[model samples]
Every structure is written in C-alpha cells, then in structure tokens.
Target chain A: GAGVSQTPSNKVTEKGKYVELRCDPISGHTALYWYRQSLGQGPEFLIYFQGTGAADDSGLPNDRFFAVRPEGSVSTLKIQRTERGDSAVYLCASSPTSFPQYFGPGTRLTVL
Target chain B: GIQVEQSPPDLILQEGANSTLRCNFSDSVNNLQWFHQNPWGQLINLFYIPSGTKQNGRLSATTVATERYSLLYISSSQTTDSGVYFCAVPRGSRLTFGEGTQLTVNP
Candidate 1:
C-alpha cells in the first residue's frame, strides 16, 4: 500500500524446520525480487519475478530455497529443511517499469 | 552476471567534509543506482545513474558507463550521512548490488 512490506520482522526456527516469509509489493508494480544478506555483507540476489512467473532464478543458492509470486503482487519465500547458515536477513523489493525499486522492512530469519 | 565493485571499502569523515565513492562494473548495464543503508538497516534510494551526471542537494553522482565505472560525491557531509553506501547495476532487469562503502561521519 505504502511501500513494500514483509512479514515476521524476525523468525527463529530450529534446523530442519520449515519457514515461510511473505512480501507485499506496492500496488501495480510488476517486478518483485528476493535477496539474502548475511552480516557484514551486501545482499545477494535470490530470485526475481516478472508478473506471476519467475524471470530468472539463477541466483537462488539451492533448490531448498524457493520463492513464489503467485498473482504477481504478494510473494512468499519458503525454506525447506532450514540450516543454521540460512540465518540472515531476507529483503524484498518491488519496482515499477524502469523505475528504481523500493525495499521492504526485511525479515530476519534465524535458523537455530 | 555482472560483477560490481565499490572502492574505498571503508571511509571516515568529519562533519562538513567532502568525500567521493566509486563503483566499477564488469559489463554493459542499462540500469545503475546508488543506495544508502542506515545502521538500523533501512535502505534509502539515492540516485539512478547509468550515464552522464546528476545532482541532488549536496549529493551528486556520475557514471562513465562507457568506461564501466561510476562515482558518488557527497559535499559538506553530516553525521546523518554515516552509513553504508551501495552501488547496484541492473542485470537483465534484476539489480546486482556491490559490497558497499562503509562511511562513518564523525561529529
């Protein structure tokens, strides 16, 4: 509505547990992106969606890390069998056609 | 896959001082942008410079895309400018961000 918004500002889950982070993009924005940022590092791209289909997923670290933007506005990043290394901040951003993107508050996922 | 590099990995400056940051990309890119991330982790947009130069207030940026590099200049810096500055390039429409320049402005 305002800017991009992500859910569960922080998440703590045990190893092997499953977690899902949500992202709500600005209304009518056609592009959505997911990224992971480890401490002391810049964000690494994970996946990008153009409308409801993923335009490029080559950045996803592994198959266990998956993202979906069904309907093109709201997206979800699902982690299966989470690992401790997966503990990092996940950020979501949305951009209108050819415009710079606006970021969300980010979800800090801590896998224990 | 474009490689983005930012120089002066870390910088410290006093209030009212001026500083410059740089970025070099590995390939031709259609979109380039600068972002500022506060210590609290909020990312704010700065500029989108793919070529030539542009200015906004005390902050200005220049991109020599033909040479695969960009520069960001901050004049009369303030403590409010203390944070990490990032340079990003659009790769096939997705942004690839650099490690960033950590700038600490002293009071």
Candidate 2:
C-alpha cells in the first residue's frame, strides 16, 4: 500500500465487548507502533513491534489490552471487556529504519 | 519515560502571518521529528530534525538537542496550514509525541 491503513475508521461497541483494530503498514517497514489519543491529548504509546516480534509492550494499560503483528506487515490490537474509559482514537504508525514515523487515519473507538 | 511538552497549546494566526511553535523534552533524545495532523486526522511528517535547522519552502524547523528543545517556524501562514502540529522523539522503537499545538489560520 502507499501508506499505513487502518480499518473501521469509527467503532461503537458496548462495554465488555471485545473489539479488534487492524493495521496494514507500509510494504517494507521494519518497525510498527500503536498509540492511543484521547480528546485534547497527544498520542500515547501503547506498543511497538520490530518485525514480527513485539519488542516492547510496556505501554499496554493492562492484560486485557493486547496487540500482535503476526507477519511483520499487518497488526491487530485486541481489547477485551472494553470499558467506557477505553473510548479514544487508536493510531497505528510505521517506520522504515528512521525515527520519523508515518501515521494512519486512526480508528475512533467509542465504548458506550 | 520522556516528558514532551509543547508551548501555546492553541494558536490563531491570520493568513500571511508568521509564527513559531516550541517543544521541550525532559530527557535526551537521539532523534526528533515534526508532524502536521490535518482536519481529517492524517498525520503528515514535516521534518526529521534532531539538531540544526532545516527549511522546506515556507516552513522551517530547528532542534537544539543539547538544550532538549525544538522549534517549528511557519512563514506566510495559509488557511490550509491550520491544523495540529505535533513533535515527537525517538524512545526506542516508539516515538513519544507532544500534546500538539493547534494552529488555526483564518483568512
């Protein structure tokens, strides 16, 4: 793809329901990242992947929040028992070898 | 964790005006970059300046790695330039973005 792509630009789910957000990064990006942004706040790191392995998952709020980049090209962020506080914009980004990252349009998930 | 802060959380400028936005980090960083998030929520990379100054036509950026700060300068602001500007730093494979400065350029 020409740029990073995220599915379900907007999502509205009932509390406690599980949801999965997907990301398709640039064709050859070696590093991928996921961020969460609340209204009026900057994006916060949720997880990072180097190839198919998750190099860091320290940013995940709790065990219920998980993400995986199985093939090194596409990634999925899974949330279990979603809470109303979980409502926010989920952002996915990718980078080749540099620190500069390219971001997706983001999925605005609303837990109601 | 790196503490990234940007000044003037909100900025309003008239078309053709010039302005500068500042970002400060609490810790040392190996790299820094700027991005412009449009109304549609697409983040577009603007600069990859860890140090020194780089200019791209009406826009320019300067980062003083030693001072742990960076500045983004917008010259001849246009209505289309109205958006949120974010500065992020390399924190391992992840980049920590600042709170972002929302710039509104009115024609």
Candidate 3:
C-alpha cells in the first residue's frame, strides 16, 4: 500500500513570495493535516481537513496561511507573502476517521 | 491545551542494548501516539496506545492514560533505531507533539 507523500521535497523562495506545498494522502483516507517543524523542535500543527471541509484550522498561524483538501484526498498548503520566519519543514499526515496518523516525508521550505 | 513532555532530551546507546523512553502529559487524552523521525526526516508511526500495551518486534509501548503518561521500550536495539522519538496527544482536532528524545545508537 502506498503511504502518504508530498511533492517538491525541497523548495526555496525569496521573502514576500508565494509557495504551495502539495500532499497526497493514502487512498480512502478521510482526514488530512498540515504541520510545521522548525529546527530542533517538534512539529507545530497548522490545519486539518475532514473530508472536503476543514474541520479545524485554529492552528494556522495567520491569514497568510491557508490550506484546502478538495475531494477529500489531496491537500495543498498555501503561503502568501512568505516571510523568512516561515522557513521550516512543512509536514503532512493522514488518517482514517479518527485513528492514528501516518505522516509523509515533509517538504522543506526555505525563505531567503 | 495539553502539555506533553519527553525525558532524557538526548540519549546514546550501544547496539544490542535496551532503553526506555517516557512521555508525560498534563491532561487526560483520548488519543496518544508515538512516532519516530528517521535521519532522513521521515516520520514513522510507531504506536497508537492510548491505554494498555502493544508490541511490534523488538519495540513495545505502554500507556497509562489514567496516570497521564506513556512509555516506549526498545529491546536489543540496532543502529537503525537512531533517530528522534516523539509522543503526541490530541488537542481539539489536531495533535500536540513533544519536543522528542533524540536517540543515537552506535554499532
């Protein structure tokens, strides 16, 4: 079985630019989540989607960060006017209903 | 928000040795899980024991939800076991993770 995966394993961009990270969850998964991990720290929650709707997005740092999981399988985390402070590894995970989560190899985003 | 803490922020072990990692939470949790982030930065799900115990090969985990803590034990560990081990608890619909215990297994 295929595990969760993310595209563009590494991305580098200038400050104030926009970037989008993609995630492909396992087939049949109904929940997706995004998180950010800074150096030497644990992952911080970003947003979550149950089905096609975002069930909880309180973890999103600000309005500049937005995510969508259309059709309940694929998700994209978008950052607008990115800042140097936003540089970190962006992780995605998926689960079935409310079970334990399986994580993907994160996309490392570097804002220069 | 529930606070999760892990002990021995860093550890070093020789291959074939045994070790135990611990996680403590500030509040009761309906969900608890352990994860291993390998050197390549891939997070692998290890266990989802909110209570009782579960084992996989040389790895086992026990969670005493009533006591708000969990323990992960590794027996006869191998070099491949070197990585960061994390424990997470649910907060709202998201998970709050611990800072993780960095393990280094020397062959």
**Best model per DockQ:** 3
TM-score of each: 0.96, 0.97, 0.98
Ranking by lDDT: 3, 2, 1
lDDT values of the candidates?
0.91, 0.93, 0.94
TM-score of chain A of 2: 0.97
What are the per-residue Cα lDDT tens digits for candidate 2 across A1-112?
5999999899999999999999999989999999999988889999999999988999999999999988889999999999999999999999897467889999999999
Off by over 4 Å in 1: none
Clashing pairs in 3: none
Candidate 1 colliding pairs: none
* Span of ten consecutive residues with least summed lDDT in model 1 chain A: A96-105
Assess the local accuracy of residue B17 in candidate 3 as a C-alpha lDDT between 0 and 100.
99
Q: Which residue segments of model 2 deviate by more than 4 Å?
A: none
Fnat measured on candidate 3:
0.88
Better of 2 and 3 by DockQ: 3
Backbone clashes in model 2, listed as residue pairs: none
> Which should have the higher TM-score, number 2 or number 3?
3
